[model samples]
Target chain A: MSDELYDDLILDHYESPYHRGRLESASCEHTELNPLCGDRVQLQLQIDEERRIQQAYFEGEGCAISQAAASILCEHIEGRTLGEVEAFDARQMLDLLQVRLTATRQRCGLLGFKVLKTLAYAYDGTAGTSA
Target chain B: MENIRSDFPILGRPLADGTPLVYLDSGSSAQKPQVVIDALVECYQTYYANAHRGVYQFGVQIDEALEGARERIAAMLGAAEVEEVVFTSGTTMSINLVAQAWARMVLEEGDEVLVNEMEHHANLVPWQQVVRQTGAVLKHIPLTDDGHLDLDQLQNCLGPRTKLIAVTGMSNVLGTINPIGRLVEAAATVGARVLVDGAQSVPHAAINVQDPAIDFLAFSGHKLYGPSGIGVLYGRRELLEMMDPFLCGGNMISEVGLTESTWADLPAKFEAGTLPVAEAIALGTAVDYVTDIGFEQIGRIERALLVEAQTRLQEIPDLVIHGPDVDHKGAIISFTDPRVHPHDMAELLKRKGVALRAGHHCAMPLHARLGVVATTRVSLAVYNTSADIDVLIEAIHYARKVLRRD
Candidate 1:
């Protein structure tokens, strides 16, 4: 469990996170913090006229599990519709990470997914932000 | 003293994956010794009964044991009277008792409650809430760059309205022991009372409440290698008598009429309902156990381990140890590395069967003062040896390799 949890893929993603910045022209942005570990994730989405995600970016601080999970989530959410992201489940996020997490680490693995889903729900394409 | 680890049964066990368990989070709570465990089992298995109220033989025996435990704790603290030692649930409850019963009664709207920025939330939050309720102002004495209290500012912080000064005897995060004697003297000159939070100090150091400067002290038994759910609040007898009861119930009241009630005397006035009898008795045994080992010997062994740990940890590149140098610190070491997040480091270390604490360590304000959101802390106990420190160093290297990309 330990070796698989810190596999090479996770380590690579954590070291060089993809889309690791805020989108100034984001239609809606949402930030969430795991108070227990002080893990933070700020996810921004630039939705187009068709309500598809034109761009997705994030920036935050946390453990490897959380940072890598956010980076993996950014790659999956970009170019997807807001409705598609809202339908994403915790199991799919766990499957994306390709690691077995204990109950405590599961929160870290899903922090990005939770934040994106929250933005999807609250986003009315009004160009606003909530933390 | 040579084979103290043998006395602690948990230290002999292994983790689920068969890794030798290296328990290092003693500042949170020390692993219990077999004698303390046996004392708890003896209470329930043989003579479990309600204490202080029972008339039967079992009750009488339990009552006598409770008083005996009180006497042992009083002697440990060097209290003039056993009544000064009031058993509470833990340190948080003890401080809450003082805040509610003492501060609420004496403090006016303009009075000041002085605390330091380095205090654990257990000591800080209670005073915050108390001052809010009493309309008194809550102020803090800032910390120096090395994490020691800024005592030079104490004279300015103390004034006529300074009614109480609450300070931690030793910081849980930095392990810096404050000069309680100096703080007490400063408070005395201004005619203000002092309450020393000994949750971190009393377990690792020897304290004598017989000093005229100290007015109140609170500590938890779990940190002293005893069972949880038991703590001691040593107050000056006069203050304990004058303050109103924090909790009122069966044992804490002398008489109750339709519209009036009279509280019980001394310790009972604060202790309400049934006490944690088994835990208290085990705590007494723990006090005796530590006394038998003697703080002088404990301090020597722990200081050696701490110096060795500091020397090895300092060798790690990019790792920053917080607080004063080893000479002024206790058995706790808190550090941060830029390459590895504290949570990640702690989780990886746990897999290697090296248990440590990470996060703000309940000292968020102090962490903020240090300019870091969190840190990984390895706090030592009597059962821990230099061998355990070696394991920790090796684990840190493994963590760096696994976590750092460059």
Candidate 2:
């Protein structure tokens, strides 16, 4: 159990992930695939009239890090503004992970974050635009 | 096997974390024996020169060494002539040579090229490229439930209009040893030439290029304990003569002019530009090293290891092995554990200093067919021992505990 990759926190979140389902009538959604290892993370967000992320959920398949990242990111942005979600960067995502990952596996940790950043970066979708 | 282990220096090296190394990725690339390593050094130190172009001392000696290696390798493959062996970068290049040079030349608009799902992409994609280029229909032999190629479907797939059949001697992912001899016999009845991708099977079993009388065979050196960047494409001489060169330059032309050029003879015609000099020589040494150990002893030891691994792995209630029974399989084992995904398990196992192959193992189509995104592969070679398997089982259990609720 010396491997930091499977610490109790990551495994717990992976086992009972938060908001791990389709977000029906989501404002916007984006999916990122790590073709190298077949990891796919789909992040969906619902925006209110105030432009805040009213709801967030994720659907993913693959490594624990990618899936766990999806849960962590979705929960982190549940009530945050679209601007704050767009402002989230790779370093902050790793800071949220609070674990060490080698350069090769950093992609796994960042897959879900990429989806969130991509969707919020555009931010032009209308009501129920996510398909 | 004791003697075999000593021949590979890396087998004794410990991992950086001070865990005793248990390498199980030889299906992707086998470890090099000291003999092969020495041959690589010897090529430059004693016999280094531009091949087929110079007439000086080192040139002649290098030429002799290179051709001598070819003769021995040809004999090992049961090839009728040494010139039938054309060295390329690796298995992918070999298949490309046949597809671009041979298939493109022969295939008519409606000709059928038969393949199966079990083939590695190296064997499958090249045929796909050629068929699209020549309007040949690419058909597949559906796999059985247990992952063997459906030979009964072979009857429906092959006909007089079928120009070629591309098959793998062994499945890289499922460890299924295909019935190449029977397949070749059936292909002959329909007048379809057969190309066997020997990237996995050549290292594990005894095969005859002549007895089955296969039209082409392709394999890589690194997978057979030789250096990387070198592969062989053994084609029938008459067929090689009918096709044009895949790559053209100084080393592969009979005569070249500003406007016109004539190609060189059989093997050299396909091999363009300067070859991988040191790697080519070392591949010969690898062939010799395995020859000295003998396929009989290799097979016996590998069979025992496979049986032991399969038996041990099956004991884990959550683990599911993907392949045929041990009787029809090779030493390779690919499996998925529902409790722990392959990537997580592989990472945790690496912490314990046991190496394995994860991801699709360059066989994504096979993974798609099996309905698995990825798997963990433990591929054994002569140097691997039962102790390695013990470490593997222990590490796997350790990995599961780390990733699973239990």
Candidate 3:
């Protein structure tokens, strides 16, 4: 049922997204578009000398799944090291949402992780999981 | 409408969740009628042979069938010669043919190709390529606030260097039925050729290339209640004769030399390699089906549906229809609800089996012009009815309830 995807938790995050503004003095930044549906996501992360993600923020325009997932993923990775963020696979992203999305919605739910994957793919880190 | 609706079997089909298919995505691709399906089946079952390659029994029957289909389609388009209607993979290929073969040959540095943002990428991108390669400039005729083209500035846009005016007969996104005749006239004033992207127009409206003197027309069969992978590119005889062939292979050549190969005559000159044999033959049946019903009836049915859809959609608050009012547009209605994202609307609406397109509808530039990222699209066809709109409205309400704060 769609209710599973539109659960209160996801909706809560969508209505009030976390870490969803510009990050000044960002060490890493990337913008990606889910070309399949035209969702725009820009990720800005502040990493410390220890390679720990000091701050994570995202700004985007898209569906609830996309917005909500970005909120959750940013919060989840705020204090984590870059290695931990790269280790976070697509499965964890969907599980983090606590919902099983239909195939199309899966793309929406994974927009943030895709941006992360791009950072990993850019030789910033060795991404253990194919996001 | 019931009789016509029954001709398309997919309408009767229910999704896995047991919801009836309330298809509003005809603008993407229309559901095929039984007649078209039957023709496709019959061709494959009875005589499925490589086109223009065989001399056997199957070849003769298929050739006759294919040619008969082509002739009927040509007549339907009011084309002067049957040879003018060249079979293409789809509208995309048809437009690309002209872009590569004709535009590349004619355009020079400092030449201009006038176009508008409402045109699907299929039309705009090809001309952009033509301009980029030849150092020709691509210009836009600014769109009206109501989504129509601003014809007032056309004279200023037109000049001696304007080689072609690439415009859509109807916008795939805005649903605005452009005045092709006026555009064609304006192009003529500048000694420019006009290529009408008829992918959306030919299915809903009647057009005659001869009367308008349209230099090139491109449209898809799938949108016209026909099988996919078959489309038509109608070029003026004089223009086609002078242009180079786009694709080269076994069928498109007149004679092969050790170092040089001459192109075949019109029609065959463009069709290279083996064709989509069954789909092309079935497209004949699709044209016949539409012809027997006639454009007058098709227009009446679609206009009524459009009016009903527009009125109902207007009653809902916070929903902004992305195009002009129904009076100025075709049966397409694109809208965005501030309370719900279009992707969520489309996804939730599908739970009730209402299939609509949600995105820029392949007109990304138009979306940018509309000052929106995406809008949900609902397009009507001849087979659609008031009940289908009712279902769509109810589904929209359901989607809103699911996705919105209320």
Instruction: Using DockQ, rank the candidates from best to worst.
Output: 2, 1, 3
Q: Candidate 1, residues B100-126: lDDT per residue as tens digits?
A: 999999999989999989999999999
Predictions ranked by lDDT, top down?
Answer: 1, 3, 2
Scored against the true structure, residue B30 in model 2 reaches a CA lDDT of: 95
Candidate 3 global CA lDDT score: 0.89
iRMSD computed for candidate 1: 3.6
Q: Interface RMSD of candidate 3?
A: 2.9
Q: Candidate 3 clashing pairs?
A: none
**For each candidate, what is the lDDT?**
0.90, 0.89, 0.89
Positional deviation of residue B285's Cα in model 1 after best superposition, in angstroms: 0.5
Enumerate the candidates' DockQ scores in order. 0.52, 0.65, 0.51
Q: Tens digits of per-residue lDDT for model 3 on B1-406? A: 8999999998998888898889899999999999999999999898889888789999888999999999999999999999999999999999999999999999999999999879999999999898999999999999887899998989889999999999999999889999988988888888999999999999998889988889999999999999999999999999999988898898999999999999999899999999898999889999999989999999999999999999999999889987789888898999999978899999888878888999888899899999888999999999898988998999999888877645
Better of 1 and 3 by TM-score: 1
Record all residue pairs in model 1 with backbone atoms less than 3 Å apart, i.e. clashing: none
User: Predicted candidate 2: interface RMSD?
Assistant: 2.1
Q: TM for chain B in all models?
A: 0.99, 0.98, 0.99
CAPRI-style quality class for the chain A–B interface of candidate 1: medium
Model 3: DockQ vs. true structure: 0.51
CAPRI docking class of candidate 2 = medium
